[model samples]
Target: MRADRLVSLVLLLRRHGRLTAPALARELEVSTRTVLRDIEALSAAGVPVYAERGRHGGFALLPGFRTELTGLNHDEALALLVAGSRRGAQAFGLGSALASAMLKVVDALPESHRDTAAGAVQRLLIDPETDLLSRRQVAEEVPDAIVAEVRRAVFAGHRLRIRYAAVGQSPKWRTVDPVGLVTVRDQGYLLAMRSGADRTYRLSRILAAEELSEPAQRPERVDLDRAWQERSTRFRTGGDQVTVLVRLDPARREELVGTALAVRAEETDADGRLRLEADFQDSRHAVWALWQLATSAEALAPQWLRTALRDRAAAIAASYTSQPES
Candidate 1:
């Protein structure tokens, strides 16, 4: 771990030019004393590190010094190349940085391994634009400025004011303490808190944003994975959840179950159809999901859902039923 920290210190200086002891400690998540010791170690190892004095002083490496650390093996290089082919980085506004990092990784490879790795990458593709059915994967667009401001607030631990357009509601401005950002399936979300209440806002739905001067009231060390999991559990359990009983063709059973929040029970009927009791987010969510199966599925319970599907089918049939032109 000390060796990793030493290498990281060198890389940090190489990237940022100069940094104070406290700044380096903060970035490296260590103590100022540790940073000072690391500096001495690097200099003793002939790394040419130097320090400046006074209140505005900091440590810096000699000009034009860069460590040629090419430690990636062949499989590792290909793994990185395949990961770089994904569009997930674009969702977090790090597309260009990812591209630049990939180039550096490729350039760092040994001359003999570079061509073979580059050629292997061509045989694999990640996150293609269209699937087998030819439906395009549409990625939401969050303005670069908004993403930057939100990111700044998240990293700086500051509060943010955002003009958000919530689904089915008018756009309104709100102040939130941003906990973290998450991008899933090309959609970006700002997981935050408002007046001590957990709030999740879609990045694309943010019309505008401004990082506030006030410090955010949040935990000093945030466990983002835990926070996200807790929020997801609350959302899944708190909403107007509905249990839907549906009869679907055996072949379409997987499709229905795949989209539902959970399957409560499942059994095969005498007619060889699959009968499933599934949990959905709400009535609207259930209707939308079931409708996608078209004639291959039928809602069996909550009489209301049946009526809704019947009414919708009738409306569609009426539209198609034509009278002779006069």
Candidate 2:
């Protein structure tokens, strides 16, 4: 662990340039004294470690100091390559450079570890047919580069001048106080305030964006996390609100709670049946929850929800009707 910490300290400093003792300690999950010792050890190994003490002071490697990548094992090398292949790597716009970097790391690994690394890479797979409309695409496929810039501005709390193409309207230039970026399933939206109205702009429809020299004031009562969670929950349920009452056995109740659908326990019956009341964003989640329940629970109230659930059940039955016995 200590050796790993030393290597991590070197890498973190190399990536972030510098970090204070307290900050390094917090990040490394170690005491300040331990970080200081690690710094000393790096210097003893001929690494040029520079230390500065003050409100703005921290530790950094001297400009010319670079570490040899001779320590990464097979597992570490494989993990790096796999990370470079994930959706986040492309989303972050790292491009093929990450793949090249991973190759370099793999080459640096010992001969014995290289075969294991190759086998691991071959076994690992990414499901491309799975939701191709990714956040990375949202960032990369805006009508113009300005939309991407506006997303960055919103994240950085900067003001923006944009030519926005509002829903069912022609594009118009506007100066907006960028609020936040919203990603719901396949769609990426920018939340901003214009004049007196709050608006959400579809990233794909944005015509252009320009970051302003001056920063905009952010809302005093903004809850970005809550907003995102609510939006995601709504999107998952297909946007029709319904309250469902279900009676479940204890085992089934536990299983239901483990699902993506948010459920609340209302009461427990005398016969040990659990009564659950849940606010569903739409009929889809309600139907999904019902299917999971099968014959274990009764879905009461909201006639449309019941109808939707029955229709889904019928579809499942229809799928099986034409199947021949093997």
Candidate 3:
């Protein structure tokens, strides 16, 4: 809002319109001569700001005059610098570049403002939970351009061309339509649709990713929530189903179904027996549920479950018999 800069800004807008000298001087709180001098200064700086001598005159940004980094309040600028530093550090191969960008912005600030920015950065702590470099070999310095480009591509619905590597798989180049970006434990994942199915690829796995010119058209009727639900349901189905028939003292039957491993309750018979069914992702997951009521447990329908339990119990007994208490 200082007079000199305000005059320069007013003249910068005049290229698109006309600002009377009086109005320009009033806005800048300066004399008409000073406004003229400011305009000359702008022209000297190679700015396209110009003045027109006419009654219908105001100020405007000339055609194709796009402002960059304009009108950022001090607090907003500081917040941006801080947030970008944190997120960029967490992003694959972009940490150092963000820090460098922040330094450049700080250097451009006024002495006092620069001190404030530097102090803030010193006081700020950016502790990412996951060491992103652990998964891949990246040169220590990360570039800011990668973070900016990836963010632009993710939000614009663009397909990405990536050279990606997976665990136990060779690195390969593939084209994928990115659906969403997932941040987990400080690591970033690009969730995408590949071969018409949802897949997750780690950002670190990507040797390179470039956005395509054309926007990717996602499935017209894709239900994201339903897709997540179906995925979880399928994973549950992949595990073994165990049916537990417990002859609890009728009082304990209710408590038995409340066991941790009980996925759901089938029914309780008249004779105080509870028929419980549960699904386990693995024997460990199932064992966790059954172990909650293992003392009062019975294998009711699936005779194989009973045999497995007996075998485990026999193994325990045999182990004890084979080795006396040392």
Candidate 4:
């Protein structure tokens, strides 16, 4: 473990260019004294590490000192960098580790690949916090300590205790045997089992987490991909899924399809509009999604949905009716 820490320490400093003892200790999850000791050891081993004095001072390597990298082709290194650049690692509280690994990859790449890949990554953006219209995408914030504890339990195959807040329900404490973790579109889920039944808990909803010493009651070998897929299938099928038929301007077809689970059928209307049968998670979802398209879309089937939309539109119209011009 110390050996790994030593290498990680080097990688962190190399990545950040300079870091204070306290900063290094925090990233390495050690003490400032340990960081000092490590720096001394690295220096004694002729690692060209030096310190600056006064405010804003920290330890740094002499310019151009790079440890050799091995076995990584250009594409592999680029893949790691691109993944690290995204919010996926942040969701799992692995941001620091990812940063260190990214630095190693960037520093170790061949001179030709390093510059080119770095440029490519800089130009390619993935999953920005907001899109072109400046509408922010909501990202669930899980406390670093809680995420780390949950991650430790998942990796060690230990039982986990969590205070969870399920949607539309009160918070409750429960113990689960962690099977694996999955992150999709910046959301994190803990795949686990409770009483031999599969359960998935959103990491953000976990008010707290405790890793227990007891072994997790999980399969000896878990095919995480298959497990997640099976669980997802069950969830999508078991819900109050609502299918809606809608007539929408062809220009906004994607707008409706984007929020739907599936597009069962599609055709052109006599008036040159697009008609689609789309499936949504629930009636509430169906109403909300189609409502966004406003006058451009209409719910053709499900009289209740049309009524709901009519009522909503009527309410809005009533609220603004006869308003004084400012």
The candidate that wins on TM-score is: 1
Over 2-92, each residue of candidate 4 has an lDDT whose tens digit, in order, gives: 7679889889888999999999999999999999999999999899999999999999999999876675544344345546446777777
**Model 2 Cα displacement at 116 (Å)?**
4.2
Measured against the true structure, the TM-scores of the candidates, in listed sequence, are: 0.71, 0.51, 0.41, 0.70
What digit string (tens of lDDT, one per residue) describes model 1 on residues 87-177?
Answer: 6567666665556667778897779889999999899887888999999999999887888799889988999999999989999999999
Q: Which residue pairs clash within candidate 1?
A: none
* Alpha-carbon shift of residue 157 in model 4 (angstroms): 1.2
Model 2: residues with Cα > 4 Å off, grouped in runs: 1-46, 50-85, 90-101, 104-116, 123-147, 150-158, 161-175, 179-214, 219-240, 248-261, 266-273, 282-297, 307-326
Q: Which stretches of candidate 1 lie over 4 Å from their true place?
A: 1-85, 320-326
| Candidate 1 vs candidate 3, TM-score winner | 1
The number of the candidate with the highest lDDT is 4
By TM-score: ranked, best first: 1, 4, 2, 3
Q: Is candidate 1 or candidate 4 better by TM-score?
A: 1
Give the local distance difference test score of model 4.
0.87
Span of ten consecutive residues with least summed lDDT in model 4: 73-82
* Cα lDDT computed for each candidate against the true fold: 0.86, 0.71, 0.60, 0.87
Model 4 regions lying over 4 Å from their true place: 1-85, 109-121
> Where does model 3 exceed 4 Å of error?
1-60, 69-89, 128-175, 205-326
Candidate number with the higher TM-score (3 or 4): 4
The whole-model C-alpha lDDT of candidate 3 against the native structure comes to 0.60
What are the per-residue Cα lDDT tens digits for candidate 2 across 1-326?
Answer: 89789989998999889899889999999999999999999889888889888888899989977776665554344345546345433332233445666777779777988999999989877635345545243334544355448756776677888887776788898888877765543456777777746666776677778888777666856787776676566555665566788777777776666653566557879998888887665667677877877888777767776787778789988988886879
